[model samples]
Each structure stands twice: as structure tokens, then as C-alpha cells.
Target: MHRCLKIPEILLTIFQNFPSTTYFLEAKCLVSLACTCRDFHAPALDLLWYTLEDLVPLLRIMPDDLVRGKLDPSFWRQWSFSRPLVPSGFERFDYYAPRVKVLTRLSISIDSLTLQDLLQLSSLAKLTDLRMILPDDDMTLPDVQALDHDGVAVLPALLDLHVVSSKLANCTALIQCLHRCTLESINLTLQNPPSGRSLGELFMVLSQSACRASLQSLMISAHDELSHSDEDIVYSTVLAPLLLLRSLYIVVIDNSNWPGLDGKSLQQMVLAWPRLCYLHLYTFELGTTHHSLVTLEGLLPLAAHCPNLCTINLGLHASFKMTESLPGRGVINRNVKLLDFGHSTIDIDAVPHVAGFLSDVFPCANIISTWDEDEFEEDEEDEEIAMSTAWDEVISLHPVFVIARHQERFAY
Candidate 1:
């Protein structure tokens, strides 16, 4: 143990694995090590502040000498920043802000910080991955004027951004700021959008940005998926510029018919990008009358052209197919692992045929008939009988039919 003590970088690397059920356990353990001795202090703190769970914790550690707000802003029924400030004093936030490379603020309630303190976060030069979940506690928060246009909220080197908030969702200024930075990934979740173009400008910003070449992944959980076509501003403004995108997920989180991309649109999109590996282009409509359904025949282009595809969830059903999997798929079968067939609302016996078809098409694949995680929880026995029977048809030939329930995504 003493011989390996010299390799602090190795020690730091080992402690930074992605946290599972116990996400904060490693951070807490690091804090304990920091208190052990001066030797462990620098390394532990370096790793501890590398990625933060929330900005509130960083705010909490600020020095007492700085001026503090009178009311606890988190629980406020009504609040407004009189003015963005130039604070006369500084504290722990300044010390730790630069070290915070990847920061997550789930339901941001900047209770302790004034506008000045909040604005100071913009100066984080090393900050790359930023995820902010705005708290719905204040209805007036959204109505409040946008943050001062003085580059206070602009993240200079931001590479990845995941923001889930109704207030921040529609801010054109924020989108404008984001356009200036080169981002690799962007995930957004917004609710109660009164109009379809709530995210229109943001899409336009990403599409027209210099970051288009560098961007790889994009996920937008909104009122509706962006529709494609020259007439459809989103496709022209968003998807058109994203030629190199490897992953694309645009689904309406809450069933809303703000109109999404249909089968024709998807096929057109696949032709535009050859690098697509993961796709979840489910129509947001929840009723039987929806016309955006994609027949199994429609996936031929995807299987033939975008050979790198590994995961898909187009809500597919077998009955819609006009044809079968191509005679010999020349494209390399990249061992696709998971699929979401949310539209496989077929008869009991038909499940095997649809599942078996998918297994044949993607040789190494698992089918998820639904994205609703809890739908089959209580009926485990029935699910096994149904799922196993479908897999049995493919397992004898193509051995990769292992299906696992969709794992819940953790916020960080």
C-alpha cells in the first residue's frame, strides 16, 4: 500500500467511477479522506469538486463574511432580484467554481445567493457539462425578465448541456448564448409549453451554430418532437444542420400532439445522416387515430443505410409492415442491444412474430414493447412467458435475444 502511495493520480482515478444506487457515497468518502491528512486534501478535493450534484451545495459552502440574503429564496411564494449586483466581497464560491467542470443543479433553488452570486457562475472557464433543473416553486419566476444581458450567464466552454425547466426552456437569449459555445451533447425537458415553437429558436441556434460539426448527441423531451421538411421550421433549422449526429431522441414526454416527425420524415432523416447509432423517434400522440405510424417495411432503409444503429424505439408493430427484412442485409449488424416497440399493441399470439422479426433483422437485439417501465412490473410471470416465447424463435439461430427492462435514468 505504501509503495503505491506515490501515485496520487491513480488513486484519484480509481475513486471516480459512476455512482449507482449510492451516487453520493464516493463523494462523501472523498470528503472523509480529505479530513484525514494534508497529503489527501488536494487530491480528494480535486475529485470532489470535479463534478457537483447541485449548485446549492457549492453555494452552501460560501464564506460567512459575504453579504447574505434575508429570506430563504427556496420557499418563497414570490421573489424578484432588484438588480444584478457587483458584489464587494468574495468567498468559497469563487474558490470552487473553477474546479466545477461538470455541474448539475436539479431543481435549482438558489436560496442563499443573490443575483450577483448566481451570475458569478458564468466566469467558470473550465465548466463544460452543465445540467440545470429549474424549480417550479415560483410561477412568477418565468415572467421575471431574463438574466442581465451582460454575459453573466454565458458558459464559455460548455460542451454538454441538459436543462429541464419551463422557464429556461423558451429563453431565446440562453439559446443565443449556447450558440456561441461548441457543445457535443444537449438534452432538454420542458413542460406546459403553450405554443409549438417554444423551443423553435433553440433548435435554430443549434442548427446554425459553429458547433454543428462537433455535436454528436441530442435529446429533447418536449410537448412534441420537431417535425421535418422545409415547411417545418424545426427540420430546416435544427435537423438539417445536424449532419454528423450519432444519436437523436425527440419524444414528447407528456402525450401531446404538437405534431412530431412521421415515418416519411424519419426515412428522409436517415438518408441525411449515415452515422446514426441510437434513435428514439416515437410519435407523441397516444390515441389510435394517429397517422404517423411507421410500417416495419419503413425500417429497411435504416437497416440498409445506417448500419451502425445499435438501439432504436420507433414504436414499431409487425402488422404495419408491407414487406419483410431484406434478403441479405449487406450492412454490418452492429449487435443492436435494445429496442422500444411502443406501438406493438397487437394480439397475444402476434407478439412472437413481431419480436422474432425484429430479432432476425437486428440479429443481436432485445425488444421493449413499451417505454413505461412499470407497465409489466406486476405481471412478471406473464411477461416472461410472452417474452421468452418470442426469443425462443430467434435464439436457436441468432443467440442475442437477451431483453432487460429499461433502466431508470438518474439525474446528475
Candidate 2:
């Protein structure tokens, strides 16, 4: 082989160019290259095992007699051991497990081996990003307990954790497992709004654990109906502890109301993160009776602080009265490119004032708002239509104000 072909970077680039649109085809081509010579074996195998969407490929490495499931087509992606697992079955598993860096779409079945069994088999030393769907029905008390022992994380090197589930119980259990790892990003989507206790525990684990110092991005979304009790837990109480995470650059919370989120609370939250670049807090979906206590005035602090902030979305009640004496009158934030106020109501008469105010605060921001078509009632349709029209007017009128402000500044 030529000296250039021997270079690791050159070989990797060549392997990357191989067709990847088809998994089995790519695997076959890599397998052929691996068999061709000892030089190509290691790198070929590394790319093949770099990302495992599921554990099926790893389990396929075991001896045919040791594991079973070919009897039925339903269990194609799943398998169970025919007999008690022995160390010999893990020889091939041990070799390839260390190569995995990203694991996603992992599904745990109640009938199959538990997470504890997998963790015991290999530490997955190189696994850095893990996304799993933890079914509440498949998880057991012992399975979760297995991860809580000795303060040792199952995936110690994990940095980004993404959990999407309809239930909060299993999601909470999985998060508790990573207390020992300093995860940099956490994206959680739950169908049900977490109870105050669950939310407290979740925040507590992130704040008190190794994650507090290293966490940079957090995105939590609850897609179910909000109850009166759920409304009482203010966002500040559950999320304020995160202020210690000075490295936080992005924060997103959707359909979760912050009952007491006023100008003071907003100011405190925005000021806590100097590196904040994106702030998206959609407290209430459109057409809902619920509205944030914050008005357009609440956003003034964002202009003064958060220099790196570029994308902003907040639910605020915009009215002409507040616009008359808008806070941070002269303060400007040119970094902001788009301002999305979800389900926020705007008085028809206040469109011009709100537009000019936003232009002054976020001179470069493009204002937009959206409503949930499914949430509006027949009687409220007219009101929502009016609100949508008013916000549309603001969007149209904003650029004119932006130009006029620039001219005024130059004239000064």
C-alpha cells in the first residue's frame, strides 16, 4: 500500500466516502475491506460500530446457541437468552462495546435482558451521547435501583442525555442514574406535566449533582393538560437552582406556566447566565385563558444583560398602557434575530406601540406569534382571529420602526 493510503486520516476519509445510505450494504462493503488486510480491519470496524441505533447488532455477535429469538418474527429487533448468560457469550460483545460512542433509539423490553444486565456486561467506556425511550411498563424497581448503587454511573462518559416518554416516573429514574456524570445537555419531553415533587427532585438532582457545573443547555417540555396544583409551582422555584450553572447558554420550556414570572424574576433569571444565547419560555399555548404576568416591559433586562442572546421567545401580555412608559426605553439588543412570543395576547390598539417598543429593545428582531388551532373554542375564535391580526400587524410594522430608530440615532 502507498504511504498516503496508510495514513489514518486518509483511510478514514476514503471509508467515509463509501455509500452509507444503505446500512447493510455499507456493512458488507466494510466487512469486505476488513477481511482484505489487517491494515483496514481496525478502522473499518471502528466506523461500523461507532453508532448503534439499537443493541440488535451487538447481540448478533453472540453465539447462536447462547441467545434465541429467530423462532418468531415479532421479536426481530429483540432477543432473549436460551439459558443463563455466561462470560463466554460476552467475548465478542466486550470487543465491540468499547467502540460505541453514540447510542440512540434503545428500547428495553420487559421480557428481554434489563439495563443492569447490559451495564454489568460492559461499561460502554466510550459512550458519550445516549438517547433512550424508557417504557414505564418495562422498567421495574430493581432495574432503576441497579443504577443507584455505589454512586457509579452506568455511562460515566455520557455528555448529552435525551429522554422522550409519556410517563415521568421512568424518565425520573433514568435521570437519577446519571447523577455521577457531568452531563452538558439534557432534552426531556414528557406527555404529562410533572408533579411539583417530581419537578423538584428532577431539578434537585441536576443542581446538586455533578451536572450543575457542566450543564450548558436544558430543554424541558410537558405536552399534557395543566392542573391547578401544577400551576402553583413557579418556574423560579424549580429552576432557580440552575442559576449556579454559569455555563448555561440555551434554555427552553414549552407549555409550562411560570405563575410568578414577573419583571423581577425574569431579570434575575436573565442576569444569572452571562453566556445565554437562546431563551425560549412559552408559558401558555395560544387561545388559553392563562397569561403570563410579564408584559413587554419584562424583556428590558434581556437587552441590558445577555449580550450573546440571539433567539428569544416569551409569553407576555402586550397592551398600549404598558407601551406608553416602556421600561428600558433606550436600551437596545442588536444580536437578537427573531422574537417568538407564543400565545401572547396583544390589544389591537397597542400594535404600533408594541412594535416600536420591540424595535427599540431588539433592533434586529423579527417579531412573530402563533396560536394553537386545536385549543381555540368557537366563541373565542373571533377573539383569537383579532389577536392574530394584531400580532401580524406588529410583524409588518416592526421593520419601519427599526428604520426610523436607526435614522433617529444617526440624527442624534
The top-ranked prediction according to TM-score is 2
For model 2, the run of ten residues with the poorest summed lDDT: 69-78
Model 1 has an lDDT value of 0.52
lDDT of each: 0.52, 0.74
Compared with the true structure, what per-residue lDDT tens digits does model 1 show for residues 19-93? 535647877888887798766777778888887755656655654443344443223222223344445333566
Per-residue error for 67 in candidate 2, Å, reads 15
Q: How much does candidate 2 score in TM-score?
A: 0.73
Poorly placed runs, candidate 1 (over 4 Å)? 1-122, 135-153, 167-172, 192-196, 222-260, 320-334, 344-356, 371-412
- Once superposed on the true structure, which residue ranges of model 2 sit more than 4 Å away at CA? 1-115, 137-151, 193-197, 222-229, 286-289, 320-327, 372-375
